[model samples]
Target: MARPQYILQPVNPYFIAFSLAAAFLLNLLPWGKLPGIPDFVALVLLFWNIHQPRKVGMGIAFFLGLLMDVHNASLLGEHALAYTLLSYGAITIHRRVLWMSLGVQAFAVMPVLVGTQLVPFVTRLLMGASFPGWDYLVSGFVAAVLWPIASVVLLLPQRRPVDPDDTRPI
Candidate 1:
């Protein structure tokens, strides 16, 4: 049997804003005290970057990273640099990534997320900061694991009735 086809629908800008805000709020939750929690903001941002590159890009990533730095009181530019690179990676292969199944997409994103984490890790190491332990790597894995859930949640708003101009079947 042929696989089902999913039509691409245009996304509302406000919906993107709401999702980003929600992700930031999730990041701000008290879960910081709990180890192994991933960065929801990064995950959401990466999702948008891949699916809606026109709307979210490096500038937004940098700005969000700055906001994160303020929220976490971490070294400035650490996340900015990391997010910038993450955004770049997403934009670079977004088409390829989007073409894959959700499970495979998660696998594709694992390296990019892990690469993002490396920026801060290396920065901290250079500044003589102690290693945050193996658990620090857990966030990337957690984010990778959450990829399919996030993809479905974020894509929900974009999957609407087919547009009349488009002849593609839903």
Candidate 2:
């Protein structure tokens, strides 16, 4: 039997576009005061962080975070700072987290999610906005909860290995 040839492939543009669209859609969803559906963009970003860290890193995170900031009409650097920091954290643990079980990865991401949200929360506080209440933290919990699902979804396509030999013309 011929040995399976493994190739280091470039990142798929489709996945990047799809993930970005999903993120934007989720951001636009009317989740007014809801506790379950937090920032889907953040959840998906975490998925990509582990799966394709090189392709999607702080630059993408910063851009997406800025979009969210503009959409939400919040302070300009609020989400930007949070996302930049989150991206750095994700890259730091990408290797170790990749080898862990899904549950473990999800649990590990929980704090990062919370921390991302807290940055904006604390920023608002410092800017003299009234306390936004604990409800704000709900988004972090929701993001964490969705991490496993997002990871599974993003990884599904990559699970099936491609046959390099099959590419030869008949």
Candidate lDDT scores, in order, read 0.89, 0.81
Worst 10 residues of 2 by lDDT: 2-11
Question: Superposing every Cα of model 2 onto the true structure, what RMSD results?
Answer: 4.6
Off by over 4 Å in 1: 162-169
* lDDT (tens digit, per residue) of candidate 1 on 127-160: 9998877678778888999999999988987777
lDDT score at residue 64, model 1, on the 0-100 scale: 93
User: By how many angstroms RMSD does model 1 differ from the true structure?
Assistant: 2.6
Candidate 2: lDDT of 50? Answer: 70
Compare the candidates by TM-score and give the number of the best one: 1
Global fold similarity of model 1 (TM-score):
0.92
Task: Show pairs that collide, candidate 1.
Answer: none
